[model samples]
Structures are given as structure tokens and as C-alpha cells.
Target: MENIAKVCSRLIFLSVICLFFAQAIIADKPDFKYSFGCLDKGDYTSNSTYKANLNHLLSTLTSNTEIDYGFYNSSYGRDPDKVYAIGLCRGDVKPDECRSCLYNTTNFLIQHCPNQKEAMRQDEYCILRYSFCNIFGIMDDDPVYTQHNVNDQSGNLDTYNQDLRTLLDGLRNQAAAGGSLRKLAEAKSTGINNKTQYTLVQCTPDLSQTDCSDCLLSAFGQIPLCCDGKIGAVIFTPSCNFRYEEHTFFGPVADVAPPSTNTSVADIAPPSINTSAAKGNDGNKSQTVIIVGSIIAFVVVVVLIIISCIYLRVRKPREKSESKLINWFIVKKV
Candidate 1:
């Protein structure tokens, strides 16, 4: 009986230790999804010289190209005659992530849409869109595609969307003011109902004021397809993208100031940034859990000690009595 009790206690202890480590791992991780956008139309100008010019322009620029430290751009540089394109990255991604994503997207744009010069790729982290026609600051609803979460988290639609919009808009304002070197913004909002949300918005630096705002608004409208009725979602295009979720997927806001609007890709550029150079939002959930858990752990330890002392204090006399009884019975039998 004593051996069985000891085995049961050992199992219980192991189970509790496993549970604690599992909780810690679950508390610190983030959920990130990926996506891309493509524009299907591109008719190179009929003039041979113009086509050559266009190809040279394209060879020089990629659909989504990393220009400076943390900023990204889309080059209509494909056709110098009619320059129009778009590039964007998330506000929280580090400069290296921004660069790496852009570099990979350059290949993606060329590979996925090789024959079609107008194609674009919209991934979870960045977007690359270019066209023969002027697409800046103008709304293009023709190729708009909305994607939402495959699984529904809850049916609390109204409150979720409202909180998402407010948080996103605030993030937008912050991104717009990011200036010449960097333009990105991220914010978190907790609803009155205690549901928490994280939002991130970003634009390419080359875009004009009106163009930046309009492109973001256009992407925002596509949320119904991406994030509506879900715990998290990302809406993006080659020009701009917005995302919000119950988790903090974004890394960190750069301490670097905004780049100048007119700062061209040329001249004194920003330094190459490392991915770890910036931090992630990490959400408030973990912090709250850790604090509460600490208090609970402390309380549990105190209670366990008290209970153990009480058991020992009570068992000592009883054990002595039991030993005496056993000895007395033995004497009687003898």
C-alpha cells in the first residue's frame, strides 16, 4: 500500500512539472500566417525601343525591392516612361526581415509573374505591386481579393471589428508619420470586454501623403475577406497592408526617426538593419499571466509547507500511539 501511494505521488509531481513548462511555452509564442498578391495585366509598349527601355528599367528595379535600412519600395522603374509600382512591409518586422522579405519577393515577383510584367505578390510580411499605368494614390478595386481565417474563433463580430478598426487607424497615423528613412506603426487595443487586439500598418516612403492614405484605406476594406470574424488576420497589397489579431506577431518599433519624404533611393542611405535590431510587441497577456502565476506559485508553496507541517505535527502522536498498540498486541499474543 505504501509503495503504491509513493508511485502515485511521483506521477502527480511529474504531471505538474510538465504542466508548468507547457504553460510557459504556450505563453511566449506567436502565431504568424503568410500571404501574397498578384496583378495579372501588363502589356509592354509596342515600340521596340520602349520595350528595351522597359526591360532595362525592370532589370534595374524589382517588384518589391529593399532600398534603405528598413524601408521597402515597388519600382515602376520597369518603364521609366510611365513609372508606377508599390512596396510595403509590416511595422514590427526588423530591418533585416524587411530586407530579406523584399529580396525574396523580388524573386517571387519575377518567378510567379515572369511573363506578366504587371503581376504582384502580397505576403504576410510585405507586398510588391507594379504596373504600366499610374497606380499611385489611386484605388484599384478590380483585382482586390479578400482572405479570412479558415477557422472561426467566436461570433462576437460587432465588437471585434470596431476595436480592430480603431486600433488599426491609430497604427495608420503612426506609420504615415514615419518619415523618409522609415514608415511603420504598430499599436495594441484592449476592448472594454477584456478582449485584446494588436494592429500594425505600414507604407513605402516614396508614396505621397494622399496616395499612402488612400492605399491603406483600400487594403482596410479587404479585411472582411482576411480577418473578419476571426481572432487574427492580415490585409495587404504591394503598396500597403494592415493586420490585427489577438496576438502580438510584430517585432518592434525602430528607435530610428522617420525618413524624409523626398529622400530618393540615392544619396546618404540608412544602414543595413539586423532582424534582432528591433523588438516584438509580445502582447500584454504573457506579462499579466506571469505576474498572476508568480503570486499563485508563492501562495501554493506557502500552503503546501503549512499543510505538510500540520500533517507531521498531527501524525507524530498518532504514529507513536500506533506503535504502542502494535507492541501491546504482540505482548498479549505472547
Candidate 2:
């Protein structure tokens, strides 16, 4: 009995150690979500100055605390040996996850693309890219990479396509209109058989609205060739990208209020209002009252119109039935 107890205690201790190590290994492991392009633009020797600059630039990418919004663009070195890098994370990704993704993806790209002067790698959460040329603010839609689920959508293709297109188009517009920090939108729509189609669209915030729109539109145009009726798909470009699936694949999004339309003169007044605190407060209160009253009046008018239309519609059907019965009686008498 003493020997048996010793053996059992040993086994339990060993199991606890094994469990701890297993969890550690899992936590440290990188997610191998690899989709990359080692472009044919150019290559550098192992000891080249460009390689050193590239290393330095990429090293700064993940370490910078100022890039909490998830877009990083920076350059190192000068003239012929300069390197430019861009690291972008999905809008819904938290800052720590974004940094971790960029770190892993940068390491993966370095291993895979070696001495290439231009290379781009995309994982599930982020995109890491470095180029010999200036890639900021400019839109590049070529060399689009796409991935899709093997299972095809089991529904009406036309209806599915229409629903996906509508969702993507709206998301594109919303993302394009985003500010310089981040340009991204996620939404869901009911498709064929009432399945909810989840979608995310995004652009590099550096791109102008027109450029972003064009880049996303170009990505949208590739769905036919790449994903067709797949239940899920992701299309990637340097400037913009989009993804869609039948199931939710993104995190919660913070709601953004629509731009207010009350643009009275006082609302746009000069900065001198800070000097006149009492006047400014009064002006703000007046504007608030006017805006609230306007909204109430608009709602009242719309409600009255809707009630009148409903009454007319219901009365019209009854009047038509009564007239038909009267006409039939008159014909019978004749």
C-alpha cells in the first residue's frame, strides 16, 4: 500500500508538470496563417545596406507604441538604400494582438522571402509588407491574393451574390469615409435561406477616399474569378481588402454615430468663443433647443402622413367591394 501511494503521487506530480508545459507551448506557438507574395521587384545581397535598413525598419514596426490604431508606415536609411515598411492589423484586433501578429508575420516573411527587396505577407490578423519603392498613400490593386472555403454555398447563387454585393458595397463606403487613423467596417446581412453573411472591408487609412474606393471596388470585382459561390472568402490587396463568411469571424465593433447635419452659423463660429465662456454656453444651448425642436416637428409630420395613408388604403378596398356588389345587383334587375 505504501509503494502504491508513492507511485500514484509521482504520477499526479508528473501530470501537473506536463500540463503546464503543454499550455506554455500552445501559448508561444505562432498561428501559421500564411499567404504571402515575394514579389519579383528586386533582390538584395545578404550583406547589402538595404538589407540592414530593411531589418531596422521591420524591427521598429512591432515595437512602436504610437501605432495603437493598427497602421504603421515608416522608412529607414536614405536614397538608394532606403526601405519602406507598412504593417496593418484588422480594425477589430486589439493593440497587443496586432503587435504580436506583426511580429510573427515579419519573422515569417523574413524567413520565406530572404533577401528579396520587396515582399508582402498576410496572416489572419495583420499584413506585413516592405518594399524598395514608396508604397504610402498610393493604391496598388494588382497581384491580389485570395483564399476561399472548399464548401460551396448551398443556395441560389444569384440571390447569394446579390446579398453579398450589397453588404460589401455599403461596407466599402463606410470604410472609405473613415478618418486617417483606421478605415474599416464589418457588417452582417441576411442571404439566401436567411443565413447571416458576415463581411469586413478595409483600406489603408493613408489612401485617399477615391483611391480606397477604387481599390476595394477592384477587390470586389475579383470575387467572381476567385471565390464565386464559396461560403467564405478573403481577398487581399496592398491598398484594400475584404472578407466574408456565413459565420461571424470578427470581433465586436464600436458604434459610430452618423455625422450631424445641424450646421448652423453658430456651430461653425470662430475659436474666439473660448474667450467668451458665458456667450458660448448660451449659443450652444440655443442650438441644442433648435435642433431638438426641428427633430420633433419632422417626426410629427411623418407620423401624420403615415396615418393618413393607412386610412386611405383600408377605405379604398371596402369602397371597391361595395361598388362591385351594387353593379352586380343592377345587372341582375336589368
For this target, which candidate reaches the highest TM-score against the unseen true structure? Answer: 2
Candidate 2: how large is its RMSD? 26.6
C-alpha local distance difference test of each model: 0.58, 0.75
Q: Tens digits of per-residue lDDT for model 2 on 207-292?
A: 88989999999999999999898888889998888988765566654433332354321112111111111111233235446755
Residues 228-247, candidate 1, lDDT per residue (tens digit)? 67666666555666666665
Clashes of 2: 0
Best by lDDT: 2
What stretches of model 1 exceed 4 Å from their correct place? 1-33, 43-69, 74-85, 134-142, 150-156, 177-182, 224-226, 258-334
User: Compared to the true structure, candidate 2 yields what TM-score?
Assistant: 0.66
Error of 2 at 76 (Å): 0.8
TM-scores for candidates 1 onward, in order: 0.59, 0.66
